[model samples]
Target chain A: MLTPARLAQYVLPLMVLGSTQLMASTAVDQQIEQLRARVSAHSVEVNRFEQELLHPVDTRVAVFLTLAGRNGLEVDAVELFIDGQPVASHLYSKRERNALERGGVQQLFTGNLSNGGHEIKAVISVRTAKDQFIRRESVHRFTKSTGTHRLQLALDAHAPDYEPDVTITEWK
Target chain B: MTGLFHSWVSAPAIKIFLLIALFCDPAKATSPTVPEELSEGVVRFALATGDITAALPLQDRLKGDSADYLRGRLLLESGNVQQGLDTLVQVAQGRYHRGEAALMVARHYGAEGDADESRNWYQVAAKNGFGETRQKARFALAELQRHAGRLDAAGKTLAGMDEGYWTAVGYLNLATDFARTDLNPSRALVSLRVALAMCETDTNRERSKELKSRLLVRAGQLAYAHEDYDKAIGFLKKVSLDSYRTPQALYLHGLALSEQGNYRAAMQSWHRAKKYPLAYPGVEDAWLGMGRGYDLAGYLGQAGEAFLAASAAYEGERATLRELEKRIREAGAYKSLVDDARNADLEWFLADSRTLTQPRLAYLLGLIENPVTQRAVARVAELEEMIASLEQQERDLTVFMAALGNKPSSDTQGRSKQLSADQDALTNAVAALSGPNISPAQKRHIRELRDALNASGSVLERLSNVGGGNNQRQPRKRQAERLRKQTQSLLVEVRAVRDEAGKALDRLALEFIEQEDQRMAFALDKTEQQIAHLYEYLALKKLDGGKP
Candidate 1:
């Protein structure tokens, strides 16, 4: 067991361990210098990321305007005029009430305005068993010229979520 | 005792000991109330044989009498009530473990609604120092009082707990005592609250916490009934249903939300309360609260849905005479949204259409804020519809423009000049040098007609190129002219089209304004609701236990 080969093996392992320790210490010293240089040259941009063009409230809107009542609500009557001449009204209070009550009320619109100001008026009145309330009145203007006109009509109606998945999928 | 125990299906002490063991080391998950091995075998045997007969023969080999009383209970639970009763009766009359046997027999009789028989055995067990038996005796007596409509007597009997047993259980009983009577709920709450504080261990604390939550909810109900909205809100505040199913508490919370003008929050609370499977009679009202919240908040769509659900749920439910109409009214409120949303949509759409463009954009913008603040469904619909119109108009403009690519601009100046020259010479040419062929007035009119012809020159030039332009300009121009005779009409349509490229500068300006206005409404409404909710919550809390 105490042969020259054994002594040589033990001595070689000791030498290898000593050299590795020496190398590790020098490596640590070199890394410290390199880190200092990196720190001195550091110029980082701290930018805040932003999400653009994603609007949170772009969904179509639908509402059935009515005056509150003790017994039940009443529908709003709509009268439309083009240049002071009575034009066809797409919606009247009674028609609106029946359609909305029945369901799947999607307001569709077409045709276009060739720019410039046009006036629109909306009035809502509630007639009930005991009293009547002129709930809402408004007049506004719309203008379009030269290009294609985009028109959106929304109807407010909420049914139930009890329909089967297949039925709901077919709504569109 | 063996005879009695065998007749009883098992024994009593063994069952409780097993349960205690299971409770002690919960880290070791158990398969069922019975041992896992017993469960598998029993289940298999029961399924295979369609009765307990086969299970009995195979199950007798399993060694353990620890759950003997529980075994009898299992029989009862499995719907063999008569057999279970006989087994427990035999055990009670057995020589060994007389106290446990008597307790089981008492429970069996009590379960069967045989109060007299249960009381007799309970008394015997109580005399024999069975603590649980003594409590049953008290409960039975209280029930008897309850059945007899003697609220005071029931409460007194419950309160007659021995001083040694004056734990949270006693307080809970006291709460129940108050619940069934015309007593002050606050007093009942106070009693329970004290008991909650008196809990000595985790189990007692957990139990007391639940009881306290329930008591507070009841107290809230009483206060709410007395029109003490703030007090009721406080009672339901910060209570979680993790420990106990408490619909009354949630309902009170919703009630407070509605009172505070936080209709959306109130709706949420009521909706949650409606989800509770075991609700009080007021649960129906919780559904009503959801509809009412939406109606008040102006969220017609959600309100209608809530009302309809409430109506459906409460269909054929019994109610007080006054509540009959109230229920119908709630249902009717739901029906109103159809018209409500319509009105809102039309009104909002009209306003939105006018306000979304420049010059009048700011003015129309203000009209929608209040409606949006109310969360009007129709208002939302109109906003969306109008935006869609604007967006479409912009799209069509681009498509038509693309279609008319490479078209030359028209030049109608020559015709205009010729017409103008003729108008100047019309009177000179018409007036006969020798004789007055036309009157002075007629001559002037002829000159004006020539001038009008001169004016038509430019119009003709517009027409000439309209026929030759890209993609037939005549039809489009005519369409535009039909909408309005104003000059400004031409400019808005011109800016609307877009290719695959981004929207034209003008269209962008217009569309951006419209979309931003809509987003502003939703934001404003949401913030207003939130602020109102906070204010109400704080105000109610102040009124409940502090300053208002």
Candidate 2:
């Protein structure tokens, strides 16, 4: 039932079609990859523009949030105020809370602050292991200099007190 | 440090890269090395941000294998591909992440069209990697060899790479390569049989089933085309009834049977094919074939009835196709096309049967599943994304401009005077150093400083002249305004390109639908012609008073 020589003559077109289809698929794949790379590169350019021009180093201030301890303090929400003006606020999703617990630092807010004394207030809501809800407020006053200032809010809940100890430290 | 950087200034690309690294953010430049205890936290932060430029300085402070791996990744992310490949090669030489690094290097070389290097790196990845990575490398290596027309090598490379989808696909591709290049049907059939066996063991159940059906139909068609009735029948008979290729396989099987003088078996195959939707491949042809089979078997009454059924089905199919063509023209089908176009799956063409089976879209499956149409549709989606990104950049610039307006005037004036004073001082230093009293080494040092200063001065001039700002703040504001303008122009260009791409997709879709409609029309004409032949034969027999 098998005739190799004659069958080869008959099936040549089909083989050509199959190879063309495969090559077309590969070409499409390459085009999509190139497009993805171009988009990524464009995004980086936009980010550079934002960082260098829009938010100049002389007046830029970044606020970062970090969880310092493994105590049973589950952050529900955190709201930030600068000079009594509402600036940044976020309600923690389970995933975000887990990331914070695993030593991930979140940049809560970044904006320009003129060279002068400014007041920052952080209102944090937390849930204890016993299902008790507690709200705590921490205020810190720091003078913004003519250079970039990065502030980190370290929230630690130790066993003895389990009070939300908010320590505000500047990176530079 | 200044002299080293100054020497690099001769190369503009390196200078620009170094400038971004050194001056993009003053905070990074001033910060001390990250503490060992804090490195993990910093790494997490960098990963969370997903910004290569932002995390670059951290790479300098972080040590060990993970940091090197991240540095390689960051270089790639930053679009410094050559540097990234070099870094990855170093990482591949290390004990940790060697397999992963080698995999990356292989992929990079593959994309760069360095086939030999790509093959070498793929072998290295296959040797060092475990599980998925090793399988992927082997599959890619096989693909590269096949593309290079080295069928035997491709097959050997795929010999023992896992028993899953990739391995099965490799064999299938190898079979195709053999057929196209060697034109050896025997070898191709052997490879196809192996591919089918591999398909049965593939973990991806749905994909394997789909691929198996397609392979069976292809093999059957090849045999049938060569007049090998028994082989064709054997292959076609194995296709599952519910498979996407069922109608095509049945039609081909009937043809093979009829050629073998088995009219009853042929009619049965055609009847089974008719039970499928008329929109399916070969169903219309099968309907006509059924009528002819009955006529040839001397069942006149049954043949007449079969002709009537075939005519009715063709008329209905014609009506449905006309309605679909009308809808395509009215853009009612545009949304569906766009939705399907966004499918990023690599095997989308092979899997399109699932989507095209919808009642409204079934008849258009041939056109929609076409690779050219899919490519056009995907291009349209990509263009839309580009336009969206440009618009987002414009919005960011708008916000930045608003902030610029609120900046204090005193700060602006002070910075402007400082830059101007610095520029004047640098110019005076260069002039003073040009005197003959200077030592040769000192003269060369002065020349280097002058060149670096000249470079900085030109940048300052661009900022000052464009903004018409006598001060530093104006330059920043002008820069934002300039970017906003550039973004707006790019948006216009991208939007125009997207419009053209969208129109092209519409054209391709409509063209496909019209072509399918034309095909059905031709089939209907042939069915009518066959019916007329049966009617005439019956009339001649009745008039002669022969068989009756």
Candidate 3:
């Protein structure tokens, strides 16, 4: 009773519409998830020596971080910051002359600590094997000693790569 | 010797230098303004030609009105003292970078060793800009104060530095500046410690460690002065004075060792000190230690000789040191102290050992006191007369304590107490007088001044022996105490002489060269007289018109 041609047209149009809708929905959902995960895996540490950042008269100090324990964690980048502004950043451990470097033990960067006290924050990125990246922020604090003071940063895969952004209103 | 010295002094080479200085005008001394193009051209020329004289052609044309400061500087470098000063003065009046010119003048005065004048210019320079010129002026002011032994002023000047500029060297210099102050030894030590701490983890730099050692030595000396001998020794033990730190550190270490009653070690230190130039700053103390150690060890002759050498080393510089040696030598101690003091200070301390002051003072005062202590007193007198050259050294613990009436350092209390205990020792010595009898007035004056110094001198001597604690080989500081006493007596006489000379010289000198056409000279002389008047109005102006 029905022609073969009419049946084929009607069936083909239906199949095409359904497949396109499914693909569009899947892609949109994956993109939203990726954006959320991008900031989730990263962690941060903040430390402040003084209520206000202290600047030593003429001393050289550096910020340090450790990346040993976090297996399956891929740290794409790290940012060192002072008073909310980025001072230095490392990308994929490539050879660069941004700071004075030493092997293995820890890196010493030449920069002055503010005199009274300073709050330093480390913003790091870590991505899982599945590419699930999270951003984190941690803080360390210090006061200027008549002697040298140390700042230590530890990295762990157990932490997320991204954290909610914090805004600092005042800096000294 | 005279011929060699004369040849060096009157070298024919100096004539050429003088001629050059007189005739060489800066070729590029003229410029209307420091036009960028012109300044660049001149710099290129200077750096290229390397002929400092080629800059002279611009001199008068410069008017010191344009690139005036540079012109003034060139003029000064060319030996046109007055002209440069004039041009610089005009530039300083203009609103340009004259602050730098003022500093240039200050530096000029400093090189000439006129610290006071240098300070005046530096102060004016400081008001100019907030840049390098201002910072330089501050440094110049601090240095001048330091040179004048006004340590407080130096410290105050450096206090303006923010935490950002506490360079290691600056910190060390600041410590040194504060070390010479009325502030106690502990404070000075703290200053040095602060500097040391600031050096932090920069251990790879030689300057950091080298300066630390230098600071440690200074801290040791201060602790020694403060009677914290143990602490002094502790700090001193931390470093070796291997390089340039040798003379200064080793000397202080020896002082600390002597304080600890480690005489054998102290003597060794002193012997080591002797290998350097004799006239070096701290060598006087080394001589004292050497002689005193020998005395304690019963090598009386050697002790006396060492004392004489020490006395000579600081003859005009430290009147008390010289006098102490003379007295010990004359004390009938079976050896002569004057010869040793003279040998140490004169023969060893200086490249040129001139005996004009020590021998003259001793020769004039010999046979004036009791034979028993005459040897001692003569050494004391020589030491006292030398104070003019070592004025700063005179304001030590002994002198300070004497003025303040503080207790003697623990080590010397017994000796100082015993030395003053028996009137019989003094009376017996008086009986031994072979010279003309001294009038009661002179004796009283001498006693007043000498006794006035007793407290401080005793303290100073005691400090030389105090330690963390030890006995037996507990070397006595009595030798030092006795010498110090003798030194006090000598100072009394020297002060009297200085006062007399000062008064006489204070009179007018404009009459000496009153040539009619020399009105300029006459005016200059009159100004000098006015300056003297100004000096009298002020309590302590340190005017070269005559005042140490």
TM-score of each: 0.30, 0.53, 0.31
Compare the candidates by lDDT and give the number of the best one.
2
lDDT of 3 by residue, B1-548 (tens): 00101112232332222222112122211212222323323422332322223334434444433467766665554445677788898887788866877877776665445666767888888877466577657755665565567777777776664321233334556566566655666566666776667555443344445556666777777788788878887887776544234455667778788777788898888787665543233444566668768766766556656655554544433344344334433442212322343344323323332231233223212222222223223333333334432232223223322322322245445654575544446545544643467788877755654443453344334333433222301121232234345445545544554443322222211111122114323333443443344335343534435332
Model 3 residue B441 distance off true place after TM-score fit, in angstroms: 99
Candidate 3 at residue B537, lDDT?
A: 39
- Per-residue alpha-carbon lDDT of candidate 3 for residues A1-172, written as tens digits (9 for 90 to 100): 1122222222222221121111122232233223222211110000011100111212224444444342555555677776666666655331211111211112212244433467777787656656777777877666543223345454555445432232322211
The RMSD of every model to the true structure, in order and in angstroms, is 40.9, 16.2, 44.4
Give the winner by DockQ.
2
Q: Write the per-residue lDDT of candidate 1 for residues B1-548, one digit (tens) a residue.
A: 00111122133332322222222222221111123333333433232322332133233334344234434544443345566567666655655445665766776665445667766876665555355456545555555555556766756766664422233444555565665564556666665565545433324333435545655666676667666788778767745464232565777788876777777777777777776431132455576677667667766556556555665554423222123224324532212222232344433443422111221212122222222112222223322332343343334334333332323323333554565576557546644432467788887767665554544443344434444443344443343333222212322322221110111222332333354444434433443454455457557867899742
Q: What is the interface RMSD of candidate 3, in Å?
A: 43.9
Q: After the best TM-score superposition of candidate 1, give how far the Cα of residue B387 lies from its true spot, in angstroms.
A: 64
TM (chain A) per model: 0.33, 0.77, 0.48
What does DockQ give for each predicted structure? Answer: 0.01, 0.09, 0.00
* lDDT string, candidate 2, B51-128, tens digits: 333455556566765777767876675556667889999988888778878998987776555677877898898999
Q: Candidates' lDDT values, in order?
A: 0.40, 0.68, 0.45
Question: Which pairs clash inside model 2?
Answer: B416-B471
**TM-score of predicted chain B versus true chain B for each candidate:** 0.37, 0.59, 0.37
